[model samples]
Target: MTPYEDKTIKDSLREERKKLKDMNGKDKLWYIWEYYKIPIISVFVSLFLIISIASAIYSNRFETALNCVILNSQFTSESTSPDDYFDKGFRQYINLPEDTKIEVNHSMSLSFEESAMNDFTYAELAKLSAMITSKELDVMIGRKDSIDHFGKMDGFTDLKEILSPEEYEKVKDKIYFVTSDETGQKVAAGILIDEADFEKKTGLLIDGPILSVMINSTHKDTAHDLIRYMFGL
Candidate 1:
């Protein structure tokens, strides 16, 4: 309205503009402090640096350097005890591409005798064997000497009792189920199968506990995946 009021407002605007221009002419850091400063920027910067360092270290770890991980391979080892060494060794063997099917032979019974090591109580092993046969995936099971044992244990008896005759036949003898007791040091049986067979036989889409343990003692994640896939969890 009034000329005087307008002049006063214009003077205030000029002063503000002068201050902004002066600030812009100063060091960029100073300008940042003036108008773009954030209270927690320092914290965010620190966190970013920390995460970057951690990622670098992790990427260079021995395991990472070795490139040891499973993709889609399938394998088996004795599931008697939780031997971390054997489990790790097995994991190293099976960690492959997602296309790799890891089938595992697992015996549920615990007979100490070499002949009875993979008896019927080992329904898990039977199921795995069935899975491998059904999927026609290459499987490695047992130990060095147990290939013979695997041959003897072949049948539709146990699996047929639990699954359809066709299903049982599908996995009857299609696995390289070994019985390498490793000088009687390892358990009697475990078998490997494809992921599809695992889902069909165990009704789970992931590696079951028996197979997971054989792969790695720390394969609880695999076990969880198996359960989750099978149960829709």
Candidate 2:
């Protein structure tokens, strides 16, 4: 009501306004936090949940690698095992765009014939064969019996379609071509084993383990990469 009191009050209000106008970054942030705290907390919580779910899904898919399988005659060598050859000296061997476990223990064995030195239990092999038919199988590495059995069944993919020109040249000598009964057309069945142990056993490069991708494979990109890798590409 009085002039002096009113002037003092106006001066105080002006000072507060100037302080607000000249607010620093920290002060500005605090102002936002105070006014929109509830919404800010909600946004962060939603983001946290989204990230968590995405991480879990990625982890499961990455871990499973969609049932990468290898049904083969069991390895029996004095100097090395198939497991060592694959899992060891492998991680640093190549830098892939995606991370694969490259494991060879349970991942590599599926019982086709107990007579062929297979390690897979009956139940396990049955499950694997189901995955193969479903096109969930990523890769299959097997010996002649298994390869012949699967290839004739039209279970394997033709490598010719996926191989680059240079790649075809490298593997042309190594791959086996078979006529699938269903299509009556020739396709690559598998790659012969080039490992040293097999050579030592036979005293020469002969038919051995064959690596292949499936025709209806879901992970076709990764499967192609693996078939190329079989030839050291």
Candidate 3:
């Protein structure tokens, strides 16, 4: 070979060796993935964080929905305003106040038996129709008192025997029936209306299935607001 060609070949070999030596050890290992590791790890971490946040938010929403249903079912009430009352009518029975008084009084003069009976038969039959037909009064009597109906009953054929025709009509359709005794008689003689129909018949506000005692004694604004929110007012 010529000396000039041999010198050029040696120089090329030396340059290649220097480049390989410079890239040895940790530097070579780091370069293998240096351009991609940081971004890949960052993307995975970000995805995990986002998924965790979404799961937490979903769990919270489920808990909230469950709480709302439970509260609404337990603390139903009647609305006082005409508009609110109608809105609640399809869902509940309501007792109305004759007038807002300094002292709101709830009377419990009758039992579930009496209430039921009064709903189906007049007081006269209760007093004197003991031997009437089986379907005459027994089947007709309701099991509870009508508090919101203001002690009223509609389609009560016998109420005129106890009340003036005018008085009976004024209060009958507005009556609410409750089980006279805690052991209610299973009489299906009274009117069965939805919340709205009850309100229309009685002129009262009602929300859910709360007891009479609770309705008369408790302040209803919070219960009403909760119901409105839960059910979407």
Candidate 4:
């Protein structure tokens, strides 16, 4: 071989050895990403699409802007002016104060699976994980399993702290509370809706699911107002 060709080969081998040395010292996650980049990219893409589509839907519908994000099994509320609609129909809006005229907008997301311990996949939790990580979630209305799942994630605010003394007095006896043992501290992981209210509204006498605020919610006041409106407080 030519002298210049020999030098070029040695330089290339030195660079390859240095790269190998660096790669050997890389963290576990770096190696995992390198090996599973395609799947990781797909998961993130799906999560981004979910968030983007939800954002688009919210922006287009609520020009007044979102007051909260509700992650529920299903969304039932559609009429933005429910107070006005019910007011005209049942003459009940007058019961609410004039200050309750806030235009509360919500971005809702459905659960990926029903059970927290079931055959749920990582991709299923992608949207939820992303939302919580972004600190954008406000309210979550869901079942005990979901509450337990998120409560373990340590992202949900303690409802006991959020509810006022008077309000808690009214609701304390109505709903059921689920306690979670976190670092030896017993925290409320979930709360079922008032059985009387559920039966009155849905005609189902069974005890129902829960609704709680997110720990990182930006619109706590708005969330509280919506809750008051919902429970007819």
Q: Rate the local accuracy (lDDT) of all candidates.
A: 0.38, 0.65, 0.35, 0.56
Question: Could you tell me which 10 consecutive residues in candidate 4 have the lowest summed lDDT?
Answer: 82-91
Q: Residue by residue across 175-198, what tens digits does model 4's lDDT show? A: 534444555454654456764554
Backbone atom clashes (below 3 Å) for every candidate? 29, 0, 28, 0
- Using TM-score as the measure, which candidate wins? 2
Q: Per-residue lDDT for 124-147 in model 2, tens only? A: 667777877676677776667667
Tens-digit lDDT track of model 1 for 1-233: 88656787779779766767775455655755765567558778989999999998765552211111122223343433222322343344446343333333232222235566554536645654554455332323233233344434442112222334554355445323332334432332333445554434433333332221122222333433332332233
For model 3, how does the per-residue alpha-carbon lDDT over 180-232 read when each residue is reduced to its tens digit?
23234321123322455434533433443222212221323333333233233
Q: For candidate 2, report its TM-score.
A: 0.56
lDDT of 4: 0.56
Greater TM-score among 1 and 4 belongs to: 4
Candidate 3: C-alpha RMSD to true structure equals 22.6
Worst 10 residues of 3 by lDDT: 63-72
Better candidate number, 1 or 4, judged by lDDT: 4
Local lDDT at 103 for model 4: 37
